[model samples]
Target chain A: MSRTSSDAVVVHQREPFLRGFGSFVADVWAARTMLVSFVRKDLMIRYRGSALGIAWTMVKPLVQLLVFSLVMGYFLGFGDQIPAFGFYMFTGLMLFGLFADQLTGGATSVLWGAPVVKKVAFRRELLPLAAVGGALVNFTFMGVVLLLAYVVTRDFPNWHMLGLAVPALLITVLFGAAGAMLVSALNVYARDVQFLIDVGLLLMFWLTPVLYPWSTVQNTLAENGAPSWAFELYMLNPMANAVVAFQQALWPGVDEAVANAAAQRAAGEPFIADFDYFDSAFATRLWLMVLAGAVCLWFAQRVFARLQTGFATEL
Target chain B: MAADVLEPGVAVSVEGVTQEFSLRHEKTLKGLLVSRLRGRHPVAERFRALDGVSLQVPTGSTMGLIGHNGSGKSTLLKIIGGVLTPTAGQVRRRGSLAALLELGAGFHADLSGRENVLLNAELLGLSRREIAARFDDIVEFSGVEQFIDTPMKFYSSGMFVRLGFAVAIHAEPDVLLVDEVLAVGDEQFQAKCLGVIRRFQQEGRTIVLVTHNMGDIEAFCDEVTLLHHGVVRAQGTPRTVVAAFRGLLAEDERERRAQSAGGRDDPEDPDLGFVRVARVVVRAGSGRPLDAFVAGDSLVVEATFHAERPAPRFVGTLDLYEGGTLLHSTSTARLGVPVGPLEGEVTYRFTLPDVPLGGGRYRIAVGAAPDTGSPPWHQVGDAAEVMVALRAESSGPFALGVTVDRPTRV
Candidate 1:
């Protein structure tokens, strides 16, 4: 028998919450420490063993840019048409890599952490969040590389570009967290997801404007005398909005330090306006990202919390 | 309960909790499809794994959870450790909790042993600085310092357990849970664990240990909770609960022997059944069945079997086991048993004269079949009862005839 000491705290579950949103807030707040600790562990463990160690965290994107610049820039001759075209391609690949890593890793967190779920009880969503958290470290590194590229080629640093990266990333994090929640939960019911994710990622890769820029697509559309309303269909691809923001953040442009040089190609202007191009697109991409990000985060957390309560039994 | 008694520092309290899990009827692919089509949710097939289990332990008590596999001992421990939530009921606790349910559950195979230790410590809620402080202790305690730099994939299972156990116990939870016995890998490691446990107990930390070994129950636990079939069968001092636990095992052994009753040829005469053995209980020949044995006392191995009808020279097999290992086997046919009727239960008691086995739990099985010519592999009467006993001052390796031989001192 136990005596109720002052330190003996009990978890009180009341009859009902005011509504749906209240419990979500409570669950997240209660589980916040677990989330932070879990995420930190993920990031640390990923970079623990390499010879280059944490430096490799930044090198993957740098190497990807170099490889892409050499092959695409030299052979394809696409650089002649666009300003510092190699930077544009590398920027696209970097963003795509981050998105791909997050979705794929987040989706598999539940399956991979099945042992922890079945054997021990903790907040289950952290498993996936941890996975995405690992990806975010990589994204952070990639973001630095983007800034470095600006230092190397641009006239001066435009810190305003931080706007596009920060909010756009918040949007991406929500989508990733949601995807992890859904995937991890689904993994419990059917194992087919373990393999299907790779194929799905491959398809989404081609669907996003990762290796190619949207400007080229819009240029083709300009021949039709108007921006391609058709190119707007691509934004429906979910992660496309994040890619748009990345292009806007890392676009090759000169600032006040080199305005004379910038005017060699109308540096003050970003891109010729067209609803089809990412930079000149409709105002909805930002809001679309916000709405999708919030919905996905809310939905994913709720699903993970509800589903994990049963995971020990089901597993 | 007194108000001051219920004040701060009570480690854990559990009340009226029940947990159920389903055993799917058919493991077949078609069976899965059919079950899904029938709209039979998992609820239709689930079994209650734990039923209305309640427990409480003070802040500084080392408690043992004793039960057979599937008896819900581990399940209850998991719930108490906060690794699992009860489907019904509630648990309350004070202070932080650390559980070693599965040692090394998070260790990655590709990582070096050193890296894994740090990673596992962090996983168990220790910070980097704390891990750094205890890193050497962990390595030395595990006795894997030589292989610390090597990948874990290269380490032996014993090495793996060492690393896991060292990292876990060092983290030092206010409340700790241990599952299964520690005798599987090595003698040296087991000794170290026992030492660790004893120290932990003296410190008055709350620890819940789940093991089938009664020795661990008697040695470490001040109290024990006997779980049976997803329920708390008994709860009391280690001695009392252990008695009840043994009683439950005896009942199960008898039931098994009863089902294997009639002879193979004749299924009609339920009463006059096969000479399949009924039970194997140990006695000191003192009329009363002692729970443990003196190191050099006579151990009487009693085997009871049934005889359905009269038969020719048939062999009866008896195998003695300690901690699930067969120590010795003997057949009655070897002693020239010609013919006997398989009509009623017969008891064969073998006097060991001196208990040679070391400290551990043991079970015996007896069965009657045919001749043992080819490999002595046939068995008919296949029933047994588990025996939990401790050997006093017994040493290792096949009845050495002495505890330890000391060299002559000049």
Candidate 2:
């Protein structure tokens, strides 16, 4: 094993694992229809025979919004004062849900489909991508629920925020596929990875700006002169940009003119002013997330190709 | 005799393929559980599953792959099929190859038989148009038409096998590879599968078959390779290769029971043996084919003598142990069968049908008798192995648990 990560592991002692061009490309591509059918089958099978069936995709997000609005709106005291707090949490929840869903679903796709992986040779990458796509399909219902919420609320969501869907899907998919590729390869050699994902998900859930706002965390870190390692969490956390973008999209002008006025008034004087520095350029965060997602995806492709050779025997 | 023309192009070529497996021994069950749960270094040890295996299959030729268990027969097929990648070696294929190493490798249970047909056909590189054109024929051939709409999870094992086989043969590839899938279908289905293979043979589609069944080997293969312990021990025509296979089986019997060849001293393995040890071995036919047993073929048992000094007149008992328990046995003392005087190297040729035995592994026990005064024959050594094969089922003795009780006197 090389110290640095490599996509290809050309083992010369034995016959190569992914030997010929016909199998490497054609085998994967030949299974294109199979991949589509399998992805469709997975979706059908997942929601099959259930009372709500796929309605749960929308219902789950709506239910979260209803309960959060009651608790965060009345109890926590951030009611109408913070623009659209209900929409704020809904956007965060939707984006965050995508990130979590992609990672969990994609990460386990290969292991979950060990039957196909071990028994035959097709594109192993398709398994995880199918998972990402399944979550993507479920996004449609969630869209309807978000639209319904926007109609019910007075705050009109701007058309600019509609861009979040594509980038969110792409970024979440890239990160999700990367995570899945890495974890699926790792899980073949270790059976206890399910438990590892359980812990990792729980920790990352609170760490990401899902239930709360980034302002909450940024305010805490700004109080201390030394910016913490937690700052990099924004870069690494896949949901941070998407979630913040959604909140910015649904709730227009969240941090209003008060902070800018105060900053200009205090600028000539020898006093520092508190303003929304990170907020001024929050849309770029989603773009950065897209870039990060692509990077992870590229990294994942290389990693998976190298490690996938070990899967047949390892499984 | 069949024509011996091989097409110019190579359908499949394997060059210097070697597959190594890491056998984790340092981590026993206890160690593995301890380390894995504790998050320590996972233990692994290297094992060479395949070593320097190379072969070529010219287009439009029937090649037979024969090997004993653990001989890398399946591994080689998987690599050729691209289901498995070799740790080292290169496999080159010119055109599309439909590898049937295991039938229905990609079938889904939740999908109906009809649905699976499309999925499986598409998987075999068939276009939707092709699958649609062949749908009715595939359904009719599978004979699962009535149950086509039922989820495959509800399919009977035989129905599942039929559907899989139906989809596979219809897919039609330039190179067809078949493993032991014929064993799953009924006699009629097996015959039909063989017929399909014969058609492929006639069409000049390359076919490589891996089967323990000599019937399949003799019937279909124009060329054969016999493998032993991951090495090509023999390669030639079926007749010559099978003869070599029998020779290898006999050699394997000899190697396996090298310990109990009528031992002169106390057997050292305290754990495996202690009961006045003797020997164990299988009676081989003239050619010594492990998979060759016929209705009245004369089978011979070769044994050497072992006894304590001042040899007692011990009765020679041959008990057949099947599945670790005695099924039926005979002794020289209780002879309806004849037992001649003992010599240095004794050989007994018993008619195959005389034993009324079924198929399976039977241990040969040759125990010694004591003089009338001595304890009724202290046991000598106790180890011998024999397998009965029926011409009907060359895969091996199909008699799984059919035990014959010695005809008790009325």
Candidate 3:
């Protein structure tokens, strides 16, 4: 190791923001290797004692998909009503899994790292970021299973429609990362934040359109004489809009099934009723959520920086 | 405080630093609520662990911080290490720094020792390549190579700290803050650690060590600071500051004994007798108060006494002790000088023609008793301290002046 010169000196002062946040940014960048090491440690610790090890990442989700397909597809006969119902549900669940894992892991990250945080002086934001990194690693593992399903079924997505998945994935990730940073810092002060996070995630799971299509919710709201603002309020949930976007990108059967229903009705033939799956304002909602998520992420980082000063003493 | 730049050659400069912590007595919500319902509210008490402490450690120099427990020695070290941001004031430090506040504090118990080494090194700001280069040296020094693949939980506590110490020393930090961690491991390993510290000194790396062991402070430190109740009481050469710290400890001990003695009401106890040694002072033969002296100098011990009732025969004994070992002792009875039935106040003095003592701090213990072999009516274990300097050519507890005989071969 070479000697650090006098110009590269470090000053530990209270409220160092006056010296500029640039130094903090530089410090974090300098510790990038430690970030990678922490992410690897988190991933390794999760599977350390398991018999199947990383294979369990694939098996666990595959089993959840099977159980969901059996209960919601075969028993409810939605397998016949909707084309590729299994694919649509699987893609939505995968995205939701990413969001859930990021939130839970991020919120409890500081508590799990009590030893290192209390003992070592480093960029503490790395702890939650590492958790988010670990969750992304798991997301990639599940994506492999989804790709194989697409290959095995021979039902490829519309290449143009698949481009929409980028914004959808960004929305989920931005919100997840933001929530993690905010909750993790708060959790250090009061452990109750994690339990609150658990309840919030459970509520968010049902609010997201994973188990059913967006049209089902739209039709139900219409029948209840709900106002237009009520529908707009539902779209305000970034996770809901992201889920709808992912389905538009990855699920190919919705457009064809809707066209088939219209043609049969025009011929005066007995046809099963089906609603249009596309949302006219989908693009606008996606951009709006993305902009909202950026603001949220910036605010969360500020909150984390403020709270982290107390972490060493409190822990 | 002005943000004055630290002068060149100063590795660490802390100015008017104070650390305040809000101590919460109740941590759980349930416990808090129950206590509040009973009309007891646990308010956060602000405790200042360090109060406006300032110091400068010169680059390439070793500084020792000596203080009693809770005297802010470790807190000051933590502030310098950047482990805890001071509640007030600023710390400016040059070059890369590493703190060995607690050994193996970053280790994961479930991970293998090899994995922990990599992870801990990264946590301490070592790059991957640097760790790879030093990995073998660390393992060899720790002496746990055969069990490197095993989880640290399987290793003994001694092995655990050795591995921690090994990695930290090899980090080659420009400035290292150590908090009494060298006391760990076996004696042989401890010696190895001391050797490493000496090598670091030779390399001109700055080190700030906080320890209670005065021997280490004297042997390794170029400068020492004594802290009492979160403030610096003295700072100077290791010998002078260490002597001042010992004086502080003695004063604290005496105050504690006095407090406890007040609670005891044993009238028959000889310690409560009327005859008492009022004050004791040690000085050189020239009538100067003894701060220090060259070896073999004449010494004078004076004691003032008050007697309400005294026996016909009495004894005034003075003892010179280096630590707990009594080096020399004398009494009026042994000298054939009579200190008889006395009243009111009297002064007793003893003069030694020549003193043969080591180059270390010694304490003067004076006592007054009515009869021989009876409990002392008044005794001051540590009345005054005198520092003796050894001759340049001599070593050990006694400065025995010896002459080498020059003669023809017989």
Best by TM-score: 3
**Could you give candidate 1's per-residue lDDT for residues A1-315 as a string of tens digits?**
222233554522212222354565665567665666666655555666668876786676677777767676667654543455565666667777776677677766766565455544455666777777777877777768767767776633345664676656666777777777777776665555656777887788777765555555565666667656676676676667777666656665313213433453475554432212334343456767778788877776666656566566555
Residue ranges of candidate 3 with Cα displaced over 4 Å: A1-5, A8-10, A13-25, A257-281, B1-4, B25-44, B103-105, B263-410
For the predicted complex of model 3, DockQ is: 0.39
- Which lDDT tens digits does candidate 1 get at residues B275-376? 544566656754445545434566666766655554343466767655435687767766566544444556776666665555554555555654444122
Least lDDT summed over 10 consecutive residues: which range in candidate 3 chain A? A1-10
User: iRMS of every model, one decimal?
Assistant: 5.5, 11.3, 2.6
Candidate 2 chain B weakest ten by summed lDDT: B266-275
| Fnat of every candidate, listed in order | 0.24, 0.19, 0.45
TM-score for model 1?
Answer: 0.72
Cα displacement (angstroms), candidate 3, residue A162, comes to 1.9
lDDT string for model 3 (A180-272, tens) is 999899888777778889999889888877876666666678778998778777767899988888977888676776786688678886434
TM-score, chain A, per candidate? 0.76, 0.77, 0.89
**Model 2 lDDT, residue A162, Cα:** 62
Q: Candidates 1 and 2: which is better by lDDT? A: 1
**CAPRI rating of model 3:** acceptable
Query: Residue by residue across B140-233, what tens digits does model 2's lDDT show?
Result: 9888899998888998877887887788788887777777877787888788888889898888788888988775786689889887777778
lDDT at position A145, candidate 1: 70
User: Candidate 2 regions off by >4 Å?
Assistant: A1-32, A152-155, A160-168, A224-236, A251-286, B1-8, B25-44, B263-410
Encode model 3's per-residue lDDT on B1-410: one tens digit a residue. Answer: 34545677888888899888877645445555676698753334678889999989998899999999999998888778777788788888878777777555466777889998998888877889999999999999999999999988899878888888887788887888888877678888988989989999999899999887776887899999898888989999987897788668767755665565542232134444457788887788766556677666788888887775644546788888775568888777777876567667777888877777767777788877765555555677767777776557676668788667788798
Q: If scored against the real structure, what TM-score would every candidate get?
A: 0.72, 0.73, 0.83
